[model samples]
Target: MTEMENKAVGYTVQQGVATITMQSAPVNALSRAVRVGLIDGIESALSDDSVSAIVITSSLALFSGGADISEFSGGDLSPNLPEVLDKIENATKPVVAVLPGPAFGGGLEVALACHHRITFAGNQVGLPEVNLGILPGAGGTQRLPRLADPATALTMIVTGKPTSVVKLPGVFDKISDKPEHLLEDTKQYLASLNAENCIKRTSDITLTMSEEVQGVFDAVTAQTKKAARGFFAPLKCIEAVKGAYTLAFEDGLKHEGKLFMECMNTPQARAQQHFFFAERAAGHVSDFDKSTPERSIEKVAVIGAGTMGGGIAMNFANAGIPVTMLELKQEALDKGLALIRKNYENSAKKGKLTQEQVETRMALLSGTTTYDDLADVDLVIEAVFEKMEVKKTVFTTLDKVCKPGAILASNTSTLDVNEIAACTSRPQDVIGLHFFSPANVMKLLEVVKAEDTSADVIKTCMKLAKRIKKVAVLVGVCFGFVGNRMIEPYGREANRLLLEGASPEQVDRVLTQFGMPMGPFTMGDMAGLDIGYYVRQSRQAFISHDPTYGAVADRLVEKDRNGLKTGRGAYLYEAGSRVPIPDPEVLEIAKQEAARLGVTQRDDISDEEILVRCLYTLINEGACILEEGIAAKSSDIDVIYVYGYGFPVYRGGPMQYADEVGLGEIVDKLSTYAERLGDYGKMWLQPSDLLIKLAQERSSFAKFKN
Candidate 1:
């Protein structure tokens, strides 16, 4: 027996079989050292007379996550991934890969290059580089189609989702029942293969461009174009897959390389990459490090049984935690539970959940009408009405009912969390978990840290957000918090545009074309016009300074146009449909309001002006959010907008989009708009101090440190 161990790769030869194991822990990314180790191990195994076969596997659980993303900016590292894969493919000795877990991106490419692949039952594999806004650059696009059917391969690549090895029967030569016996099973399978069954190279396999192949490409292209609108990489992935059938193996690799570089150079790719990093950065809390202790959150209770409260309860139940949903009356509790079950049933009908799984999730939920029932729960989140007095009443009750050290949280989007905490004797226990509408589905959870919120509570909620599959961004206590706070100006500008003679459809079209999920007016229509009307009415003292603020929406509510529920709002909706149709009546109302307010209407408001006025105002508010330390970083605000508010991912939220637009240019545009619009614009368009300083210094929001 012979054994060799190095930093990145370990080599051993036993019983005529040489084994190469990647030693990098926690997703063995192919770094420079790992690449050199792979090359040397292959060379050594090939040269050794006693070694008849080479078995490659990972010392850790996963084969690899992909290339070292940190090295992406380093440019041209030695022994690039393609070269390392080529060395494996060209080797004369039988090369076998045993996958115990997921083989993603370049790792899947490496498995394809090997003569045979053996996997454990639960092992998964995929080429998910398209999610990062680039096609696979290391022969994955070419080789995957050769191993799997073209349609299957295209689905995996374009969606960037992993599939289990068991579902893909022929992809691997052998599947082990137990991961512990994977190596032994792999060795036995290798021993069974003679010269005739060994050394099957993927490159030599030819793929015919059948009618079905064309159908697959056409369908996927149409779907990707519609689903991933304003995004560039999904379409590029489809093109690279087509090259596998049309071009020879080597030519396909070269074509894929060209397409990869094309995707890498796009602004969308840079934006998506920034978004990926920003998501990871958002989880970090400056005051709470990894060493910070977290309170246990095994049992959870959610106050209120309305949409928001029921949705919050479902989040915990989905995570397999038992939940007690609290409401004022038994009828309300029964209705909420019924809605939860109906939601799960709908999911089952849509194939998102199995009938059995639906029952299992529902079985985790229970309802209560008394606060005493929540006394033992580790965490209690109040998702009652948005009013401060109502929030104070709930927190005050929770302070008396909940056990010491139990977390008390509010789901208030705009109310001050500090004031809510003040009502509780244990202020440190009171925090804000501002989940977006439909808490079970939306990804963002604004973790609002009130003035006296404990570090332990902050640490626990951040970790709990991950457990519930939500992206928790730590934020300071303020009216509207991070996302809603910034959106105030965005919605204000949309309203102002209406008063200035831009139709709701025109305003919606410009912003949607600019890549927002929906225009502000359409979003208001869907969310119910009265929701914002009531919020504005509650803040009348602060907003009374500006008469025109939210006037268009107020006019809609004054006319009893509630939104989609009423079938008439900013835009009209037909019965049983959510589609927004431009209403002449709404336009007439806007004109009447404008005439009453004595505001001049312009017929020539270009799409550019509409896009700039709305997005720039949103960006300006984000800068103020950052300057006040309400958000730890500009990226946190970006995360909140992207995940919570339906901001475009390809644009990387408003702050990143602002940086791309150039802070200096944004400042100049704000100055121009402020001067152009007079009093209303001056109140809304005045750039924050941080924005002015960054623009003057030619810096970006990305460079602003909290």
Candidate 2:
């Protein structure tokens, strides 16, 4: 049969099934074309005697990611997704949906309209509209409850956890061999079943609720409260699912639509959606096209078999790439190898990896004390102690030993990539691949490009990052690059706030409430206070000579309060657990430091002030980075923080959150704080010119993107 194209839809009939693929590109977003196509496809399927069943799917990665995001903001407006789902619900003939991949939001609603649904093993299903700042508008709240229990459906919809095919409830007919083969399996399953006995529209099924359901609902609500904090969509999603149990199917859908629309209009949703596209846009480099071929890297080499070096080697080996690790002595190499083996054993015990797979990865790794082993490697990453002289010496050696065209990279977090490149003959090959702590687990790689670094080298490193399951952000060379540079101000503000009388626990509580994983002090303990102390000492020239500069940190180091390690840090720690205990000594030190600096302190710090001081400091620095062209865009900064740091995903990234908070408000607050403390506060609270410009124009930090 010929493919029919409606302005709002695309239709193709094959065999006995009429397959309707949503053709909206990029995200395959459901708009007017999708709604009209859905209606027309159903009509065509019902009219044709040859078409026994209709299978709805998408021509993209998602069946339908969600409703058209643009439509929520009133661009190319059409009869919304719920009305489109209504057409599907009222169809006469049985509709079988073949969900290939993610069927979320209106996508899941489209599946619920069908009589039978089948998906592949890797397919992930959800009513994740809530994540985008909306509820599932098209029959999701109503239909999902009928398919799964009200509580399970609510958790899936509210939390936005993708429904894994292996763990899906018995509602879906079968799991197909491949995503593309879903339609065939669905059609065969439909033909095999008696039409009268087959399950029809989700709206026709009665929802079941029990005491277990009530308990699940209660438990999930509590968890969501703790997890989501003050987010509206997750809580509102719970209310919509509750409607499914209390009201009729259509009535429940009405409630869902109302809640969905409310979330769509919220500032939080707008910020989150901005982040959604920004992350996807981060890898785009206008100067580098797809023609720059990535070098074939089947093997990797690591110099220095310390903690980071071992982790870096394991990351390569885990990705099935052979890795050769070099250490100065045989004993050091043996210890590193032993640690790698222990790590694999622990992973296998935890059921994270099988014993055989762990052994397989271990077999791929080879360690040596000599640099000669790195001679034939395609890529070599240096992870020695953070000193420029040591780095230069190592690269200078590698330059002589390693073959030509080999990509040499560094795993330095906060160093000048250009200085490191100067040690190597091929500066274009030398790039900074700053892996977060415990390199094997962390998902971020800061790919720093020095001034003379080649586009091909950047491209290869990005591809390599993806191959190792890491999100790579191409950045320019700077003192701390993206993550740590912005983090400096954030940490500084947190410390200054403590000097002004807020206790460690109080500061942690406020930041945790604001949706960070932990406050600065708690994180300091976990990371070891000595590292920061060393960095502080190293950068003494950059810091103010005032008494507050390193007084408290130096005192903490002196007292053996090096955090978690010494059983004390910002707060006291028990023997085993990380649960923070309040310490009098530290409190006394903070008070003394406040007095010594001649800074007036407040006993009670409001949550609002604490949040603004800590967060705005980071935002202010991000604006400066944008103005300096250190970061190409505000979104790039967000990506760096979201992946590298523990920034909350639901709140978007820091920059997006700042945008939602209003640039003008932040600038005014900075000026207010600056006016209060005069010179002392001026250094920390100095508002960036970008922030002032954005505030004056009533623009957002996100608009600074290239």
Candidate 3:
């Protein structure tokens, strides 16, 4: 027996079979070193007379996680992935790939190049490059369609979700029943194959499209266009997959490469890639390392059985943790439990959950009207009314009933967390777990760290957020934390646009065209117009300086137009539908308000002006957030907005979008607006000091270290 081993690849020969095992730990990413080793191993096996067959597998459980993303910015390296795949495909000896775990992207491309493929029953494989704003660059787009049906291949490519090997009948020659015996099973299977079954390469397969196939392609393309919206990669993926039927193997590969490069060069690709790295970066807290101890959170309790409370309890119950919900009365408790049951029933009807799973999750939840039932709970989150006095009463009661080691949290979005903590004797155990509305669905969980919040409590909630499948961004105590704080300016500007003579539909149209899921007025209507009106009333002293602040929403609430619940708001909505219809009376109110406020109204308010005023104001607030160190980095703010507020992911959140638009140009435009509109614009549109400084230095918010 002869054995050769390098850092990334290991080769050994026994009898007539040669085995190549990728040795990179963890996911075994296809870096430059692995590519070089693969090329060498294939060449050595082909030249050796004693070796009649060769097998390629991995030392770790996973075959590979595609290419090393870190090397993408390093430009073309020697022994690139394409060259490595070509060498494997051109080998004269029979080649087989044995997958033990997931084979994704370039790893799956390499498997397609082999003469035969084998996998275990539970192993997964896919080409997920479209998620990164690029299609498979190393022959994945061309070769996968040859091995699988074009429709299935297109679906896999566009969705970027993995498929189990058991479901794919023809994709693998053999699937091992026992994953632990994969290597031994592959060797026996390779030896059993003679010349008739051994020499089938995916590249030699021909694709013939019938009329039905062409119709499927057309239908899928139209569906993708509608779902992808303004994104570019998914359509390019379809174009590349179509080349397999229309062109030869080499020409199809060339076509895929051209499309891949075109996608890579686009701004959307850069934004998506930035977001991918930014999300991972947001999880890291500089002050707390991995060694920091976290408190055990086995059982949790939610105070108040309102909408937010029920949603928060569902999150814990879904994570397999028992949850107790407390309400003031049994009627309220029963109603909240009914709403939770209805939500799960709806999901079961939609096939998102099985009846068994819904029953199991519901079994984990319990309700009580007494605060004494929360004595042994590990954590208690107060989702009571938004009023300071109401929140204080709940915390003061929780402090008296809860055990000494139990954690106390509040779900208040805009109130002072520190003041809430002051109600409890143990301020160190008090932290804010400001979950977004409909907490079980929304991904963002703003972990509010008060002035005296202990490090261990912060670490525990941050880890708990991950357990419940939410992205936790650590934010300092402030009025609205990161997302809602920045939104103050954005909402202000949307209201101001109405006073300046733009129709609600016109403003909404421009924002939706710019890639927002819905315009500000539409969002307010869905969230209820009175929510903001109540918040403004609570902060009357702070907002009293500007009489026009939230004027439109206040008027709507005064007219008893409470939104979808009341069937009227900024825009009219038919009963049982959330679609916004423009109302003449709303516009009339805007004109009357403008006349009373002594504001000048213009007939032609350009979309560009509307877009700049709203978005730039949001970015300026983000800059101030960074300057105050409320957020550790700009990417954390991006994480909150993208996951919480329906900010488009393709734009890479507001801060990353600011970097793309050039900070210098933004500062210049804010100056123009500030000078154009006098005091009101100066108060709202002035650039932050950090923003102006970065603009003068020719830098970006993305580069801001803190």
Q: TM-score ranking from best to worst?
A: 1, 3, 2
* Candidate 2 TM-score, C-alpha based: 0.93
- Compose the digit string of candidate 3's lDDT tens values, residues 611-655: 889889999999999999999999988889888998888888899
| Candidate 2 lDDT tens digits, 74-181 | 665556677777777777766777776787777777888777788888878777776776677777777877888665687788877787856665558789878668
- Tens digit of lDDT per residue, candidate 1, span 29-143? 9888888889999999988999999999998879988888878788669899999999999999999988878999988888888989998987889888887888899998898
TM, every model: 0.98, 0.93, 0.97
| N/CA/C clash count, model 1 | 0
Error of 2 at 420 (Å): 0.9
Better of 2 and 3 by lDDT: 3
Whole-model lDDT, candidate 1? 0.89
Clashing pairs in 3: none
Q: What is the lDDT, from 0 to 100, of the residue 451 in candidate 1?
A: 90
